[model samples]
Target chain A: MKLLAALLSGVLFGVGLAVSQMTNPAKVQAFLDVAGAWDPSLAFVMAAALVVSSISVVLARRRSQSLLGEPLQIPAAATIDLRLIAGATLFGVGWGLGGLCPGPALAALSTGVPEVWVFTASMLAGMLSYRWIFRVAPIRE
Target chain B: MTEFTPVSATVGGLMVGLSAGLLLLLRGRIAGISGIIGRALSQPLGDGGWRLAFLVGLPIGAAAVSLATGRLVVEVAASTPVLVAAGLLVGFGTQLGDGCTSGHGVCGIARGSKRAIAATLAFMTSGAITVFAVRHLLGASS
Candidate 1:
């Protein structure tokens, strides 16, 4: 049952990526191309998504546990430092160039574009390196 | 007269929100792409089945949609080298950040996580800056 639910949720996410055209790297690039021929469509999409997400969070928090009987996991830390700045820089530069992030990249895998493989491979490598480096001092769980 | 039927962005938003909710509910996991793929690669024995299925299903779902609705137009405006570089950088960043946008922005922020909030802001701000620098400072485009 849990497996089925996970699969269904993934499918739903893919469909959303498709319907929103978030899967298209070109559209994403256009959105990023703020100085040249800026596209506002993605902004509208982001705004709409934020509205839905904000409301959903407020409502979901009323309950102690989620529907599946697990407590919602929220990040504990709030302080910012060198680690935060550097990570954001890397992510931003990547997004500016690659035009796909983890969510859309995974969703794009279904599209069979060769680019997905490249993105996925690099993303995995990055994660692995993180694990190895943090083996002795892992990120707070 | 009135032929325009607006596809509610809310439908997709709701789908995303619901997916996050369901993933937490069912698997006791966050629907974070980086974390999911990371775990899938590292520990074959750690929650492997569903991760494989979910990752595999992504492409298949898109393919099925293409077959039914017609091929979704794909265009890579960036050069191959640039895209690859971007991928490597992102791969490195997710490690440093400890989570991707899905983990921090969508799932974490929704759960009232301050760290997620800070991370998401940083992510967005940097993304905006990169675009500004690349398009304006560097004068590169595709």
Candidate 2:
């Protein structure tokens, strides 16, 4: 049941990415380009998402257990750490450079584009290298 | 460049939110792409069945969307090496930050997390700055 729910959620999320043009690199890049050709379409998407999620989170937090009788898994860390800022800054540079993030980039894989292949492979390698280099479990900071 | 797809964008945003809401309501998990993927990579012996399932669904859902709508995402014009470099940075930085666009930008902000707010601000500012550097200063048309 848990697995099925997750799979369905993923499907819905992917479809959203595709339909919202979040999968479009140029659109995403344009959104980031305040100093260049700016596009504000993504702002609507982000706003809509935030509003709905906010409602769900607020309502769900009122209950101790989820619909599946599982304990809520909200992130516990509250500290504003150096790693978070630095990593986010680096991620932003990457995002600006390629106009790709994990979700949209993964969805792009279905298009069978070569650049998508390169980015995806490199991302996987990057994830693997984090494991190899640090030898410590990656945790939220 | 305010692309006028407000209708579709809002509808799609609702779907994204619905999916995220379902994940949180039914499964009690954040529907964060980077965190899920990163954990899947770093934890070989950990629970990952759902993560793999979700990951598999992403492409399937994308394919379905394209088939139905007859609209495909724009081909990213960056060179292979640049794409590779971008991917590496995204993956590595996300792991270090413990979240990415979906995790922090959507879910974290929705919950009014102070740390998440700060992180989101940092990333957005940096993203804008990077865009300025690449698109304006470097003059790359892609």
Which structure among the candidates has the greatest DockQ?
2
- Please provide, for model 1 over A26-132, each residue's C-alpha lDDT reduced to its tens digit, 9 standing for 90 to 100: 66667767666666555555455555566656656576766767566644667766786677668877877777887788777766788777776776666667678
Residue ranges of candidate 1 with Cα displaced over 4 Å:
A55-60, B1-10
Candidate 2 lDDT, A100-124, residue by residue in tens: 9999989889988778878888888
- Model 2: runs farther than 4 Å from truth? none
Error of 2 at A14 (Å): 0.1
Query: Lowest-scoring 10 consecutive residues by lDDT in candidate 1 chain A?
Result: A132-141
Per-candidate iRMS values, in order, are 4.1, 1.4
lDDT of residue A129 for candidate 2: 79
Candidate 2, B15-70: lDDT as tens digits: 88888899999988898888899877756335638888888788888899999988
Candidate 2: clashing pairs of residues: none
* Tens digits of lDDT, candidate 1, B11-127: 555566666666666555667766676667666556547776666555555565566668665566567777777887787676677666677767777666776778778877777
What is the DockQ score of candidate 2, to 2 decimals?
0.76
Collision pairs in model 1:
A110-B59
